[model samples]
Target: MDQSFLLMLSNLLHLHNHLDPTSALLSDAHSPTSTSSSSTSSSLLTSSSDAQWRSSYGLSYPVFTTVVDKLKPYIAQSNLSLPSDYAVAMVLSRLTHGLSSKTLASRYSLEPYLISKITNMVTRLLATKLYPEFIKIPVSRRRLHETTQAFEELTSLPNMCGAIDSSPVKLHRLPSDYNPSTYRSRYGYPAVQLQVVADHKKIFWDVCVKGPGGIDDAAHLRDSLLYNRLTSGDVVWDKVINVRGHHVRPFIVGDWCYPLLSFLLTPFTWDRTGSPAQNEFDAALMKGRTVVEEAIGLLKGRWKILQDLNVGLNHAPQTIVACCVLHNLCQIAREPEPELWKEPEESGPPPRVVESEKSLYYIGDNLRHALADDLYQRLSR
Candidate 1:
C-alpha cells in the first residue's frame, strides 16, 4: 500500500489522533471486508439515545431523507422503481465509511458494479438539483462589498468578492476505451480537477467540473466561463481588460494560480515593492482568498471519496462533477456558523513569504492591487 493510503487508514483508525474524539464505530460494528449479505436486514432503530451515534454521526439520516424526498419528483418523472432512497443512503454510507465497492457489495449483498452505478446515479441527481441551488452569485454590488468587507476584517482584505481555488478529486482509471488524457495527474495518480469560486461566506459561487487530472488550477480557469467574463473590455491598466459581455459577471477571487485579469483578486509577494498601504491592502486580499483553501479542506475532510483514487467505472467524469455538487450540498446542510467567516480584530499581520518564492510575486501583487483599487473606485463612485 502507498504511504498516503496508509496514512489515511492510520488517521481514520487512530481516533485520538483527531481533535474531535469519537469511539471507533466501524471497528465495533463490522470489519472493512465483512459481507453485509448474511446479516439480518430488519428495520434498525430510528432513534438512538446515544447522541454520539446518530445516523452517520447525526446528520446522515436527515440529509439522506431530505435528498430522497427531493429526488422523488425525478423518480416519478422518470418512472423508475429503482430504490433511489436506499441507493442514496448507500452512497452516503460509502462516503462516510470510505469503503471499497467490493467491501460495500459484500456488506449490502449487492454487486460491486451496482454499488458504483447507484453512487453515480445519486451524484447525477445531486448535480442536476442540489448544485444550482447551493452555488449562486451575489446579486448586488452592495451585497458584494458588504461580503468583501466582512472577509476583509477577518483576513484584512478589501474590495474582495470571494475566495477561489481548484481541488483534485481522484478517480479510478477506466478502461482503455475512455479518453486517456482524462485520468492523468501531476503526481502520476488518477484524478480529476474541479475549479470553484467561494464567496466571503465560504459558499461556492461558481463551479467548473471537467478538467483532466493533470490540469492545474490555471488551466481550468482558462476554460471556465468565469475566466471569459474577466478579459472582455478595454484595458484599464496595461494588463487589465473588461471581459463581461452580455452576461453580467461578478468579481471573482482566486489565488496566484491565475493570470492577471480585471475581475479577479489575489495576493502579493515580498520582492514586489509597493506603497506600504498597497502592501497592506494586498495582505488583506490574500487573507480573504484563504477561505477557498479552507472550503476545499472542509470538503475533502467530509468526503474521503476525494482523498483516494476511484477507478473501475465507465462514467468517471460525471461522477467527479456530481461529487462537487454533493460537496456543496453537504456544506449548506451542515451550515457552519457565519461567525466562522468573521475576521478577528485582534489578529496581527500575516507572516511574510520566503525570498526564494519571490519569482512569482508580480502575479499576486499586481492583479490583487489593480482589482482592489478598481473595486474601491467602483464602490466609491
Candidate 2:
C-alpha cells in the first residue's frame, strides 16, 4: 500500500473511533441530515457569516440549496463518496471567491489535488450539462417579438435580437509551442476572448470562448458557432421588420470591431460634421449594444475568477463558460448582484475591418441606413 493510503487508513481508523465510522466517508446519496454531509452547506465551510457565503459562492443559501438539489444526482460517482453540496461549495468557492486550491485544502482539511479535481469536474459539468438548459436564445416569434420590442422601447430600434461583444479574460501565456503570441492580448497580458450575445435583461443567449486575446473581435465572432448559424441561415431570425418600405431581419448590434451583416449591425462612421440621421442611428445602436458591456461586467463582477484566471490555461476558458452559466442562473434566480463588479478599460485598439462579399455588405449597409432613418424620424416626431 502507498504510504499516504496507509496513513489515511490509520487516520481513518483513529478518526472513526472518536467520530462515527460511516460519517467519514461522505456518500453521494446522503441527505442533508447525514452526519458526513452535514457540514456541506455550513457558512463555515470557508467562513462564518452568511455574507461570506454569498460573496464567496455568488449565491444565497436558498439559491445554493436549490442548485445542490439538482447537482446531487449528476455529481454521483461510484468510487468517490463526496457529497453533492460539498462538491458545489468547493467549486463555487474557487469560482466566485477565487480561492486557490492550496488555500482551500488548508482551510477544509482536504487534499489540494482533490480540491482542484472537484473544481474542474463541477466547472466542466456546468459548462456541458447545465448550459443548454439555462442559456438559450429564443427562436420563437413571440419571445423574439417581445425582446425586439423591449430593445426598441429602450433605443427605438426594431427587431433587435441581442447585443454582441467580446471581453478579455486574463490568463497566463501558453507555451510557445501552443502559439503564445496569439494569447497575448493588446491589454499587455495573456488572455482568452470571451464573446457573448446578451439580451436586454443582461442574459447571455450565445457564448463563444474559442478565440485567443490577440485576435480581433470580428475574427472571434466570425469563428463562433453563433456566427456560422447566423450567416449560414441555420439560426433563422424569421421576424423581419418593415421600416420606411425596407424590410429588415432581426439583427444583433455590435461595436465597430464587428463587421456589418444583414443579421448583424454596426455603427456608421461619422466625420467632424456628420448627418443628424447618421448620428442618431449610431447613438441608438450604441444604447442597445450597452447591454453586452453590462452583461460581461456583471459576469466578471459576480464571478471574480475571470478577473485574473488562476486556473491552468487549458481549463481557464471552460471556467469562463461555467461562469457564464452561473451568471444566467443567478439572473434568473433574481439573486442580488454585487455592485463591486467593474469593467476594465478597453486597452486594445479596434479590430480591422474584415473583407466580406460586397453584395451582402451593401444590403446590410442599406438596412442599417434605413433603420437609422427610421430612428431619426422617430426622434423628429
Candidate 3:
C-alpha cells in the first residue's frame, strides 16, 4: 500500500474518536450483536432484525442479502479469505459508520491491511459491477412514464424526468502532489465534486465525479459524459408534449449554477425579477429541483463516509460512485430515510450560455416562456 494511503488511514482513525459519543457507544454495543446474529443465520449474512441490519449497514437485511447475492460471483472470483457475504457486509459497515480500517480490523479481528484491501475491492465492485444495473437513465417507456408522471404531480412541470445538482465531498487530507488551492471548494474545504440526477422518488439515474472541488458546478457538468451524450443527441427521451406550440421533450430541472439548455432547464430569474408567469414557472421548476438536493442529502446521510471522505485521491471517485449505487439500492428497497444532511447555502450568478449551444439555448428560452404562459393561463382558470 502507498504511504499516503496509510497516512490517511491513520488520520481517519484518529478523527473517528471525535465523533458523537452517544453514536459511538450505540454502535459499539450493537456491532457485536450484529456479528453474532449473522453467524446464526443460514447464510451467515445479516443481522436477525431489520433494525439491527439498518443500524449497522443503513439498509434492511433483505436488501443486504440481495447485494451480497449480486456481488457474490465477483467477490468469489477475488478469492477473498472471508465469505463473499461477510466481505460485503464488512465493507458496508465501514461505509455506513465511517469507521477506520484500524477500528474495523479490531472489530472483525483482521489485520488493518486486509481490511483496507477488502474495502477497496468491494467498493470497486459496487461502483463498477453493480452501477450499470442500478444507476441509469429512464429510457424505457414505462420507466420514463412513471418518472415523468411523478414529477408532474410534484412540480406540475410536464415531461420533467429528473432533477440535477452537485455537492462537494470533503477530503480528510490532501494527496502529496495536490496543490491545496486546487482542491479547495467554495465551502473552504479540500474536496471532490459529486454530481447527480435523480427522479422524483429521490433515486439516482445519473452520477458523475470527474473533477476536483475547485471546479465550478457548471464546468464540472460540462465535462461529464452525460453532457456529451445530451449535447450529441445520443441519449433520447421519446416522451414529448406540445405546450403553446413548443414541443417540450423530457427534461431535467436544475438551479442557476447550471447553464440553461434545451434538455436542462434553469430558473428564468433567481431573484424574482421576471414577470409573474416567469416567477410561477421558476417556483415550479425549483420544486422539481429539490429531488436531486434531497437525493444528495440522503446519500451523505446514509453513507457517512461521504461526510468526511478519507479515501486516497485516486480512489475517491469510486468511493463516491459506490455510495451513489448503494443510495439507489436503498431507494429501490424503500429503506427508511435518515436525517437529511444539510448543505451550505448556494449563491452564484447564472452560467453563461455555451457558444456552440446558442441555438439550443434560444430554443430552451422560447420553451420556458411558452410553458410559463401556459401554466399561468391554466392556473388562472
RMSD of each: 11.5, 5.6, 6.2
A best-first ranking of the candidates according to their lDDT comes to 3, 2, 1
Among all windows of 10 consecutive residues in model 2, the one with the lowest summed lDDT is: 15-24
lDDT per residue as tens, model 3, 1-381 = 344433433333233233211222113222323333234245233214677678777888899889988988888788554456556766787899888787765654457987788889999999999999999999999999999999989888799999999999999889878898888998999999999999989999999999999899899999999999999999988888999888999999899999888998999899989999999999999999888898999999999999998777888899999999999999999999999999988988888887988998998889888889998988888
Taken over the whole model, the C-alpha lDDT of each candidate is 0.54, 0.75, 0.83
TM-score of each: 0.66, 0.85, 0.88
**Clashing pairs for predicted structure model 3, backbone only:** none
Q: Give lDDT tens digits, candidate 2, residues 1-381.
A: 344533433332332222222233433222334334446344223333345457557877666776677666678752445657766866786787677777656654558777677788888888988889889987988889888999989988888889998888887445567776788886768899999999988899999999888888888887899988877789877887688788888889988778777888887852314589988888888899888888888888888778888877789878999999889988888777666456655533444545664566777889988888888887899
RMSD of 3: 6.2
- Model 3 is weakest, by summed lDDT over 10 consecutive residues, at 20-29
- Candidate 3 stretches with Cα past 4 Å from truth are 1-47, 106-109
User: How high a TM-score does candidate 2 get?
Assistant: 0.85
Query: Which parts of model 2 are misplaced by more than 4 Å?
Result: 1-52, 106-109, 172-177, 270-273, 344-356
